[model samples]
Structure formats: structure tokens, C-alpha cells
Target: MILVTGATGHLGAATIHFLLKKMPASQVAALVRDADKAAALTERGVTIRVGHYDDTASLDRAMQGVEKVLLIAGTDEENRVQQHKNVVDAAKKAGVPFIAYTSRTLKDRSTMANLLMEGHFQTEDYIIASGLTYALFRNVLYMDVIPQFVGASVFETGIHLPAGEGKVPFALRDEMGEAMANVLAADSSGSAIYNFTGSEGYSFADVAAVLTDLSGKRVKYTPAEPSVFETQLAGRGVPDVIVQRVIRFLTDIKNGQEDDVYPDLENLLGRKPASLREGLKGLYNLG
Candidate 1:
């Protein structure tokens, strides 16, 4: 059976949605912290196993008889390194033959030190050291988040942020999940690192152009100072922690850190992922 962690999350749920298209629900299991939240999945015949990254015994129990496990990246940012290690160790102890992890794309870890990238880097090392046949899905920024980044009043306020002209190869999160499900259902063990990104990259200027064409509004891209952007978000009542996190990524974008493109996602889906303009149309409700 194949087990998917973080089963209630968007990407994990979508992965199961697509996986069911290829195999029966009897061959599927879900690792969730609370079974109550997985009632919908349970109704669909998916076996729900209570587990947490902090609890090793729970992880071991959840991995029982599981041939492949998708270790969805945990959200406990402060404690995630050790938490991910716990899951990998438990999977190793349980003798699970194959493991797939959802990770992020980091262009350079040597020169630029980022807390987010550091956590993923450490987790990748432990997974490799565990000696299990593994597939690391290094995902990029999601097009789903573009709405959040630009805000609902983007047509009035324009695209205002500190991201500059740096481009991001943003893929749809659901599409990324679809690719993961395809790999998990493969005939052979998935044992390679894959970069899950869009076929092309786009800058904020490109985003503005897309919005203009789709919504009939002349949107503009404005590069602001990080401090100024922080003040603006603060004034808008965005939480401090959330604001800082957004700025961290915006700073990375301004530095051109996440500008690379890859073919792994398209290769897995056997089709071209949605383009930026097309994705924005759906995201902004223009269609």
C-alpha cells in the first residue's frame, strides 16, 4: 500500500485525488494527526492512520505494511528539522522500501544562507543517509499564491512589492500534486530528485501585463524598498510573522535566487503545465 503524509493539506489531498484515478482506495493509506479532520477521506475508503512527525512510534505504526510513503514537508518551521528526521528514521525502522519527500528548490545554499532552505537542506541529507529508495520533489513557488502576493485590490493598487524584476517559475500546486501521485504509482521505485516548476518563468511585470489583458485593467508593477513594503503590510493588519516571511521570499526574489526553470513537472504530467496568463485568469476570476 502507498501512504501519504499531511493527507488533509491541499497538495497531499490533491495527490490522493489523482492517485485514486490510477489505483483503488484499498491500496491507499493516509497519515493524519487527527482522524476527525479526515472524515471525508475515510468516507471514500481511504485508511486513516493517526500520526505526527514529533511522535516516532506513531509514525512507525502508520508505516506498517506500507510499501511507499510520501513524506509531505511539515509546517513546524522551528522544529521541522528534527521532526522530519523522526519520520525518516521511523520509515527506515519500519522497513518501508520507497519514500518520496516534498521539498523546495534552492539555487544556492553555499553563498546565501536562508532559514527555509537550511531546513530543507538538512532534511534532504538525512533522507539520503537513510538509504531508502527516495524521490525528492523540489517544488517552486505556487501560482495559487500569486493572488495573495498581489492582493485582491491589485487592480487599484497595482502590483506593489519588493520583488523587482526577478522572475519565478511558479507552477500550480495542484499540478505539482498530480505529478507526485503519478510518480508514486509508477511500476518501479521513484529514486531521483525532481524539480517541480512551470514550463516558463515570469516577473511581476509579466504578471501585470497578464492581468491587464485578462481583466481589462492597466495594472502596474512597482518595486518598493523592503522596509516600505513591510510598513504597508503592517498598516493592512497582516501579522508580523507572516509579513516577515513574505518579505524574506520577496528579498530572495529581488536577488534573483529563484529564477531557474525545469522540465521535470511537465515530463511527469505528459503535457504542458498552465501558462502564467492562463493561470492568473483562473486565479483572479477573470474567466
Candidate 2:
């Protein structure tokens, strides 16, 4: 059976959604901390296994009789490395022959340094040293976050961020999940690295143009001072923690830290993922 961790989250849920298209739900399992949160998945015939990254016993229980595992990265940044190690360790102890991890995009850390990705790097290193066959998916920023980055009233308020001219290969989360499921279901013993990204890269200026075309409303792109942007988010009552995280991404973009473009996403999907114009239509609720 294939056990997908973090199964209730969007990415994990999407993976399960696509995996069920390829295989019976009897062969699928979900590792979740709360089974109640996974009622929908359970109702769909997916076996729900209660587990968390921090609890090795629970992880061991979740890994029982599982042949393969998709270890979705945890959100607890401060302790993620150790938590990831625990998952790997449990998978190893359970005699699971193969494992896959959801890692993030890596570039020379000139901006944000390793603050945002240290956990993933460390986890990758640990997984490689383990005896399991692995696939490390170095995923880029999700296109789903574009609406949040530009704000909800973007057509009226325009696009304001500290991203400057830096571009991101923002692939859709659902598409990435689909590609990952294809990988998991196709192979059981090989090892590989996949840099999941969109078909093309786009800067905020490009984003503004796409919005204009999709909505037929003139939207402007403005590079704001980082401090000013922080103040604006705060004034709008964004919590301090979330505000800081948002600023980190904007700063990373402003410094050209997330501008890498790659073809792995398209090659894996066997088709061009959605373009900026197409993705925005769905995001903006434009029929």
C-alpha cells in the first residue's frame, strides 16, 4: 500500500485525489494526526491511519504494512528537520523499501539564506544516507499563493509587493501533486530528483499584464519598499508571524532568489502546465 503523510493538507489531499485515479482506494492510506479531519478521505474508501511527525510510535503504526511512503514536509519550521528524520527512521524500521520526500527549490542562498530551507536540506541528506530508494521533489512556490501575494482586491488596489523584477516558476499545487502521484505509482525502486516548476517564469509586471487580460481591467504593478509593505500588511491586521513569513517570500523574490526556471514539471506531467493567464482566471473566479 502507498501511505501519504500530511494527507489532510491541500498537497497531500490532491496527491490522494490523483492517485485514486490510477489505483484502487484499497491500496491507498493516509497518515493524519486527527482521523476526524480525514472523514472525507475515509468516506472515499481511503484507509485513515492516525500519526504525526513528532510521534515515532504513531509513525511506526502508520507505516505498518505500507510498501511506499510520501513524506510531506511538516510546517513546524523550527523542528521540521528532526520531525522529518523521525519519519525516515520509522519508514526504515518498518522495512519499507521506498520513500519520497517533498523538498523545496534550492538555489545559491544569497537572499533568505537557509532560513527557509535548512530543514529540507538536512532531511534530504538524512534520507540519502538511509538504505531506502528515494525521490526528492524540490518544489517551487505554488501558483495558488499569487492571489494572496497580490491581495484580494488586486484589480482595484493594483499589484503591490517588494518582489522587484524577480520571477518565480509558480506551478499549481494540484498539478504538482498529480505529477508526484504519477511518480509514486509508476516506480518502486528507482531514485531521482524532480525540480517541480511551471512551464515559464513570470515577474510581478508579467502578472499585472495577465490580470489585465483575464479580467479586462487595468491593473498596475508597483514595487514597494520592503518596510512600507510590512507596514501596510500590519495596518491591514495581518498577524505578525504570517506578515513576517510573507515578507520573507517577497524579499526572496526582490533579491532574485526564486527566479530559477526548469522543465521537470512539464516533462513529468507530459503536458504544459497552466500559463499565467489561465491560472489567474481560476484564481479570480472568472468564468
Best by TM-score: 1
Segments of candidate 1 deviating more than 4 angstroms? none
Q: What lDDT would each prediction earn against the true structure? A: 0.90, 0.89
Candidate 2 residue lDDT tens string, 6-67: 99999999999999999999999999999999999999999999979999999999999999
For model 1, residues 168-280, the per-residue Cα lDDT tens digits are 99899999999999999987544799999999989999999999999898999988888999999999899999888889888787777778999999999999999998798
Give per-model CA RMSD: 1.3, 1.5
What TM-score does each of the candidates earn?
0.96, 0.95
By summed lDDT, the worst window of 10 consecutive residues in model 2 runs over 106-115
Residue pairs with clashing backbones, model 1: none
Q: In candidate 1, how many Å is residue 9 off?
A: 0.4
Worst 10 residues of 1 by lDDT: 108-117
